[model samples]
Target: MSRLKLPHNPKLLSHWEGWENATVYSTEGNSVLVQTVDMITPILDDPYDFGQVVAANAISDIYTMGCLPELALNIIAFPCSVLPKVVLSQILAGGQDKAEEAGVLIGGGHTVEDDELKYGMVVTGFGTKDNLWRVGGAKNGDVLILTKPIGTGIISTALKAGEATLETINIVAESMKKLNNLPVLLKNHKIKINACTDVTGFGLMVHALSLINKSKLGIKIVAREIPIFKKANELALSGFVPGGAYRNQEWASPRVIINATPAKMPFDPILLFDPQTSGGLLVAVEEKNAELLLNILKEAGFSATSIIGSLVVDKEERIEII
Candidate 1:
């Protein structure tokens, strides 16, 4: 949609800004509002778990913008006739619980009868005029840190095909349920983040590419340094890759330069383009602050966080996989 020549307004700070969070000036106030709407079908068999995951996914955009998520409205499409009311209640309860955990309020929402069930929220967050973050803020020699591991897409496909183990499902579920709350956690540390974005449907490759698209900087990703789920690599080797992974690879291959051989990477190269659900934040910080920021993230219980790559200048390719 960013490629589309859509209408634009001066108050829209993030218009046509790829898949980054949207920021707009308040019509009646000086504050900037970060908002996004997202929905997803059931990934987990339990309705409650599905609700929690989707809610986290919905509000993640606000966190990506370095804002506090304060308000949300539930969006539900359910088969009322097919499922009992208790199922619906459980789903709503799950969403409400997750919202409370994120310090957000579910004031109200809209629901419509449908044959298939879908759930999500429209999240609104706030930040000061001077603190808004953008995908294009990466600078030369900036360190790139990923907050969570990749490979959920492949594992999800495996689960659907009955090729995944119970342990794998639980591992991926825990990762998906984890909130990307680094923005809120950073207030105490006072670290300066140069760029930020949540890895989602576009996968890490496309999301990282967005960071340098508007600048002269290029990214060098250390394949071995990247973190992955315990069973994701083995599953990918067995042909459990998702359709989105193939699409992401096809879209990102031309722009990225791959330097590492398949033998050197612990996981399949396709996993680099595996789409994630409620994934972690990919942040760019100055080299001096990189270790400090990484420590802060780990202290906040983001154990999977790792320094995966760095941003560079005077490079012809948009991204280089080393």
Candidate 2:
């Protein structure tokens, strides 16, 4: 599969890491901004309903960077013969509703006829005047905190296949539907976060790798202490993992060692690498105030947040998964 032919271009190779959205490149202080547009025919059947959820997914990167939205654009690819304009309108309505909830305005976008149905958004936002929490900011001894439960990747795949229960599906749905709203809570707190990144397609390790490389440090994680969504383990056992996870494993494996045995692994490494549409904020905060920040997140209703690990020392960015 490594030799599998796929899209090949320097732009894709250079920005393959999620940082394309948050990194800046320029002179004259006119910093570049991050904006993205993505659509999934895989989730097409529920387009009208999933539009809102997916809209949020597209906006999440902006939120993770503490940026406020300025505008949005709708993108669509649908089979004109098979799907009606009415269906497309309803999908737009759903996306509009979610965009408004996030306090963003939808401008205009493009649409084209295709063999399958696809839908998503393009979101643009402004950065904080003096701050941008790039992964490089993470410092040694800082504590790691994750805001949402893991395993939504497995849960979503399960739902698509009708293998998950209403309760399990609902739990995953709620986690996905929630807007994170971390900025509201974070703005009110006096404490500062050294680094922050959203855990998406890369899973925990890939995202953590960015923080590690930027800071030049090693991480010690207590796998048992990490917070995972209900039934995540169950889904992992069933092998309902998404494909993006394997890519992440390949990228992150060299920097880390699986401290736990395969049998003892909390979730499938494949599932761990699954691509998340919109996931939780992975925050690295100063040790002295990590607890205070957790309490703030707790008060804001993200009770699942936890202190899963800490930067141990400057040692080639090795990870002890357990």
Candidate 3:
């Protein structure tokens, strides 16, 4: 993005300066329009499941910005000569179902023939200017919360190696298909969220660094408090780690500091750097409202949600993992 000579638009909001998604104020200045596009190839065997996960992943960017998805356009690539037409239909059906679940309409899209199959979406949504959530609003006394467990990258590597059990594959698939819809929960409980972002191609550490860096503060994470998928640690230890995990670690090496590690931990610290697909939202809320927000998420069936860490006034380093 830095290399590109992008135009200067006065309507662009500064709050979304470093955010992955882009938001602009409407001409009327009453609401803000949020827009984002994402795409990913098949991670699982079932085309339907792959479509569901990809759709969820693409739409998550809007949710991370605290906006409700309203419209989407399908982005597809497939080899018509190699794969049967029915496969494409099932994939579209799956995407449609998931989009509808998020109250978004698939108005139209573009498709093309390619050697390998791929699918995703471009989603748009709207929210009031006053309610816009930025990634830079975390305060010194804010508490960090993650809505989903990590390790999709590890589990995916295991599946490709034919070492993952059917049960494990099922569990990971469901997690990836889950949507990061915290705005609904927050509104229901009348809670105000300070900062938020979804964990995706970038691992938790990288995303956490993005949060604190924007706020010009530091954070301390409780390594053990972080939620992990079943058997993810074991799989990661067995050399099932993805290439993206290594890249993430290398990119965050200079900014992250390891304070301590528990003696009984199963996985190495590298697991903290594992990449994720359709991952959960990392939210920062005032310390006083942290517990109540967590309980609300739990009651709404977000079992993996937990208070992983807190922001500190010290800006010595972007993150400290203990």
Which ten-residue region of model 1 has the weakest summed lDDT?
A: 21-30
Put down candidate 2 lDDT per residue, 55-129, tens digits, no spaces. 777777677666666689999887889977888888888788888888889998888999977887888766543
Reference-based TM-score of each model = 0.95, 0.85, 0.95
Q: Write the per-residue lDDT of candidate 3 for residues 99-208, one digit (tens) a residue.
A: 99989899999999999998989999888777777776888879999999999999999999998999999988998998777886677676678888888888999988
Best by lDDT, which number? 1
lDDT for 186 in candidate 1 is 83
Q: Positional deviation of 259 in candidate 3, in angstroms?
A: 1.8
| Clash number for each model | 0, 3, 0
Candidate ranking under TM-score, highest first, comes to 3, 1, 2
Ranking under lDDT, best-scoring first? 1, 3, 2
RMSD for all candidates, in order, please: 1.8, 4.5, 1.7
On lDDT, the stronger of 1 and 2 is 1
Give lDDT per model, in order.
0.86, 0.72, 0.85
Winner by TM-score between candidate 3 and candidate 1 = 3
Output the TM-score of candidate 3.
Answer: 0.95
